[model samples]
Target: MLIATWNVNSVKQRLEHVLRFLDEARPDVLCLQELKATDEAVPALEIEAKGYNLAVHGQKAFNGVAILSRFPLSDIRRGLPGDPEDIQSRYIEALVSAPSGRVARVASIYLPNGNPTGTDKYSYKLRWMERLAGHAAGLLRLEEPLVLAGDYNVIPDARDVSNPEAWVEDALFRPETRSAFRRLLGLGLTEAVRACDDKPGLYTFWDYQAGAWQKNKGIRIDHLLLSPQAADRLTGTEIHRHTRSWDKPSDHVPVSVTLDI
Candidate 1:
């Protein structure tokens, strides 16, 4: 089955691009981040018309996540556990049965950007990572086919970014942030892209400013962390870099992995 993750920036603004992608990629399951709309505002009707089930956790004008699957989605969960007061619509998970008759658990997450480090936002970002780590540890115990995919808003390493020095002060590439990401991987999760492709300079996001895309100045922030079961079936991975050049495209592009399961 083909599973993909994309941070659409704003689902409403990029609805056309999204529709086009859904047609072109034809993934069995697609995890979306940054919907920037409420549940009522999401274009569920149009999506359903494409023969997919929709599950969304949305917020107004900000963070949101969703999952679109060709198969029926069950046990839908709307928020990340461990933080009762944390209301950001950054996570949503569901169970999807692939054509191969394998049931996999998947989640779409839009991690906080936490810009201009050394502030409350940065602290919150760290705390959120901790909570995610704890949750991931528990999920690992399930020993099922699990895919944690989305816009992680993290630069895992200098090799993942266009210029390490340029992002040193940014929250996304901070040392602490990278460490947190490493901790997540330490929980027995396999980063699908890295596992399938080790080549450097492969990126998933580019800024709109400073001719980032044109200059190929980008970073690999979007990711798919697969459980051991899913990792064993990993067949291929792709970064839809061409999408960045499309009309009114989002700064981020789709990252996908094909699994035998």
Candidate 2:
């Protein structure tokens, strides 16, 4: 199965780009983040016409997630567990049954981008990571094919960013944030891109300002984390860097992985 993840920035604004990608890439499943729209606002009919089922967890003007799959989606769940009052539409999961009778559990995640360090937002980001770690630990026990894919808003290492010193004070590359990511991996999850290719300069996102994309100043913040079952079947991985140069493209591009399962 070919599964992909993309932070569209705003689904409405990037609908055309997304449609073009869907038609060309033809991934079996796509996990979307940063819809920046409510469920009613999403172009559901347009997407449905493409032969994909939609599972959306959306918000008004920020932080939304969705899962689009060619296969039937079952047991759809919205929102990350462990924080009742946390209402950000950052997570959505579903079980997709492929035509070959293979089942895979997948989730779209838009992890917090805690900017302006030493503030409440940074604290919340860390707490959210902890909650995610706890939830991931439980999911690991299921021992099924599981994929957590989306914009993690995290630069896992100095190698992931264009300039290590430039991001030292930024939340995305903070030591604590990287540690949290490491803890998630410690739960027995395999980062798909790194597993397939450990080479440097494999970035997934670039800022619109300061000629970031023009200069190839990018970072690998988006990811697809696979469980043992899914990792075992991992066949290939790709970063659709070309998408960044498209018309009205999002700052982030699509990251994908193929699995035999």
Candidate 3:
């Protein structure tokens, strides 16, 4: 089974790209982030017409997420636990089965961008991370094939970004941010990409400004963190950088993992 994640930026603006990706990758499950549209405006009909089961948590012109499965999805979760006040539609999880009837859990996460580190936004980012860590810890107890994948909004290491100095003070690359991400991994979740290939420059996101794409200047902020059981079935991983070059492209591209379920 192939599971993939992509931050489409906005489902409305990138509907074509989303449909194109579905046709191109043909993943068994595709987790999407940054929908930036309300539930009623998600273009669900167009997507469902492509032959996939859709589960979405949406917000108006802001953070939103969804999960699309070629197979059925059950036990759908709409929000991240541990925060009653966090109304952002940034997370959605569901239980899905592979062709072999092998069940697994998957989540689409769009963590806060927390830009300019000295404000409530940054604080909220930190708190959210802690909450995510706590929730992830609890999920780990399930001992099932679980994949927590999305645009994490974190640069895990110096090797993840193009210029270490340029991003040092940015929230995504800040020490606290990276540390929080490590806490998640410390819970025994294996980062699929690094586990398969540790090479630098294998980035998933690129800034549209400053000719970032033209210069191949990018960062690897999107990720697929797999639980122990899921990690064990990981057969391969791919960074679909070509998607970033499509007309009217998003800053991010899809990253996928093939599992032996």
Candidate 4:
């Protein structure tokens, strides 16, 4: 089975790109971030028409997420637990039952992009990270295979981003954010892409401004972190850079990991 994660930026604007990637990559499951669309506007029927099950958690115009899978998705849940006041549609999880009827939990998350990191948004980002750590702890106890994949927004290390210096003041690069990520990963989870790839220059997101994609300046903020059961079955990983080359493409590309469980 192939599991992939992509930050589509805006599903409404990049619906074509999503369809194209689906046809090309044919991942068994695809997690999306930054949908920027309301649930009613998610084009679910169009996606289902393409032979996939769909689930979306979206708000008005920002920080939405969704999951598309060739297999059936059950026990769908929207938003991360632990905060009733948290209204952002940034986290969605479901149980994907494959052809063999074996089910695995998968989550598509979009961590906050707390830019100019000295305000309430930054604080919210930190708090959100804490909530995620707590949520991950619960998943760890499930014993079933769990795959948490998404645009974490926090760069794990200098190797994950092209220029460590340029992002010094960025929220995504803050030591606190990275430490939060480490704490989450400390829940006995493994980053599938990092586990399979040995090189550093492989990035998933490039800024549209400053000709970042053209200049090949990018960051691997989007990721697939797997539980022990899921990681043990990892077969291959690919960063589909060609998707970023498409016309009016999203700023981020898709990263896929194949598993042979």
Model 3 scores what on Cα lDDT?
Answer: 0.94
- Give stretches of model 3 more than 4 Å off: none
- Residue-pair clashes per prediction, in order, are 0, 0, 0, 0
Q: Following a full C-alpha superposition, what root-mean-square deviation does model 2 have from the true structure?
A: 0.6
Q: Quick one: best lDDT, which candidate?
A: 2
The model with the greater lDDT, 1 or 2, is 2
Model 1 Cα lDDT, one tens digit per residue, 192-241: 99998898899999999999999999999999999999999999999999
Worst 10 residues of 2 by lDDT: 131-140
Which residue pairs does candidate 3 place in steric collision?
none
Give the TM-scores of the predictions, in the order they appear.
Answer: 0.99, 0.99, 0.99, 0.98
In model 2, how large is the Cα lDDT of residue 71? 97
All models: lDDT? 0.94, 0.95, 0.94, 0.90
Where in model 1 is the C-alpha error above 4 Å?
Answer: none
* Between candidates 1 and 3, the lDDT winner: 3
Point out the higher-scoring one by lDDT: 3 or 4.
3
